[model samples]
Target: MMVANEDVQVAPTRGRPATLSADGIVDVALKLLDAHPKDELSMAKIARELSVSPPALYRYFPTRTSLLNAMSAAVFADFPEMPADRSWREQLLAWQNDVAAVYERHHGVMMLMGWDDQLAGPWLKVQMPVLTLLHSIGFSRLSLVETTSWFLAATVGLIRTYLAADSDGLSRSDLIEFSEGLGGLTDAQRMLVEETREWISRGDPARILNLGFEALVDGVERRLGSLQAKGHI
Candidate 1:
């Protein structure tokens, strides 16, 4: 679920001048992000929202990317550690769901970070925990980088694609037609129907996203089986 936007921030000192600490700045910046839609957020907008000079805002975050990194860090700081009691597949799916929730809230934050190659630390904080869980689970057919890339492509890539399309309004009819047009495919209708069933059951960004999650978990199980057969785990 999406979080409600809160009141505009002031210096937290109560009566006297509230110090514009990094945390406070981040608080206000996050507010601005929530209040505005994608591409509408900027340093100027944030400064105006906070009633601070743009240069004053720049003092802490030298560039817009830097401030965004801080915002991403602040968001990631809340992600829970991996659940030790759960199986590795369970833990990894749960972590990806949590990451998806955060990315949904922030919308384009990750894309912005990608644009500048910024905030490697917080970004890795999300990736490493899951990768470590996979490693602990004995997944080694693909290198960590390869597995991580594939997982992100499924989860984050799906989210970005949905957002870009304004909720993946692409009709499954088209998909089914395309599959039928692929020539001699015996199970084309069944395959496309099964794939699009979740989408048909509900709406974009959640139903389809859950399907992607299941696919990732299935991939992990397959990799685990392969490793076990080879005595690699």
Candidate 2:
């Protein structure tokens, strides 16, 4: 279900100053969230950023989840509309790149999303276009729903996994030092690690993410081909 654009943002409370408006709180929270881990961006931290007490923030957001949902709205508010002229495949690739850019920019914002489905505006903003394209290509209602779910899961999973890996993966020096310790391994195990060391140690996150996404789209295309062979369309 797509949440309306307005439904994701926090509404202003009466009596708050413009500087302490709902949008203001969301903006500060997003900035703090980007700089810190999701769990660290508490209401108190946001309040400190704004030079106010936690209670003052509660007047607008009321709870940390509300503020996080509003921040999500702010992040996705500028999600671009898909180009009308592209083929379905072209649009799917373009959409994957664009969505990757957002997740890359915000880093860990996915974890901050509200659990309540009512706050799903950011999700649908990125999801609905692909689902619509698949539907246009003759995916049945059940297939459409199932395929869209898999598409979302795969896209988000690859991006999140790579982002974490890119940041937390060993440094070059660390990798070299760790390689020394691998002498204790069996001959076959050591040979495998030596053969794949560079690839594993320096996985190009963007390239891997794009490849994973493209592979997913390729599966969708193959499924379309199978259905066409049966004259299902």
Candidate 3:
């Protein structure tokens, strides 16, 4: 997400001032985060980039947790609203694509996905659209919460596995050697294993994510139909 540089006039100084706003800190922090994992990123690095002391940052964000929370908020600041013109299923897929796009664009976001108690506002902003859609289709209370949780959990797991598999750089020779090591498989098991191996070696993360989403939608539809039949909605 691009942070706009608002035209705020400030007095000239020999060096950067400690009065740097929280937005300014978050902006620099995000740039650093893109190149460095959260565990390796230090406040001193941000301070150096801003031409200020590390202690100065605490004036705005008293702790590292607070600063990380602010960074998370900025990462999702311009989250797209689900389109009003699409069918509900289409809208849900669009939302999943948009959310996945954010994760793909900002590699650092994977680390920032941990929910922070201080970030309820930003979390709700990111989640409420999909949650409301599920609610509209007869999911309620505990089921509503569980369904949303399942979708997000599945999405995150798929992306993580996809990236790891993509980096494997497995070759035909590698797969052949690996396959030869496995013995005692029935013909059917062998076929299934080879197909899965081939798919995982070259599968598109987004396509797999969409397929999982479609499956979830189908399950939800079936549940809603059953509830309607039983007069539960």
Estimate the TM-score of every prediction.
0.66, 0.77, 0.70
**lDDT tens digits, residue span 1-233, model 1:** 11122243544323322576678888877765544434456666666677665556656777656766777788778888878898777787788778767766664455433444343578777778877776766665465566667876677766555444222233232233344454655587668756776565356546667777888878867866876888766
Q: Which runs in model 3 stand beyond 4 Å of their true positions?
A: 1-21, 48-51, 115-120, 164-205
Worst 10 residues of 2 by lDDT: 1-10
Candidate 1 ranges beyond 4 A from true positions:
1-19, 112-115, 162-208, 227-233
Per-residue CA lDDT of model 2 for 1-233, tens digit only, reads 11111222344335655577788878777666665543455665666688766667877776656666677778887877777699887788788777777766776467544455443567666678888888987887777887777877787776666565224331222234446679699999988877877566576656766788889889888878987898876
Residues 146-177, model 3: lDDT tens digits = 77888767766655554432222312222344
Give Cα distance to truth, residue 184, candidate 3, Å.
Answer: 11
Each model's RMSD to truth, in Å? 8.1, 6.3, 7.4
Which of 1 and 2 is ahead in lDDT?
Answer: 2
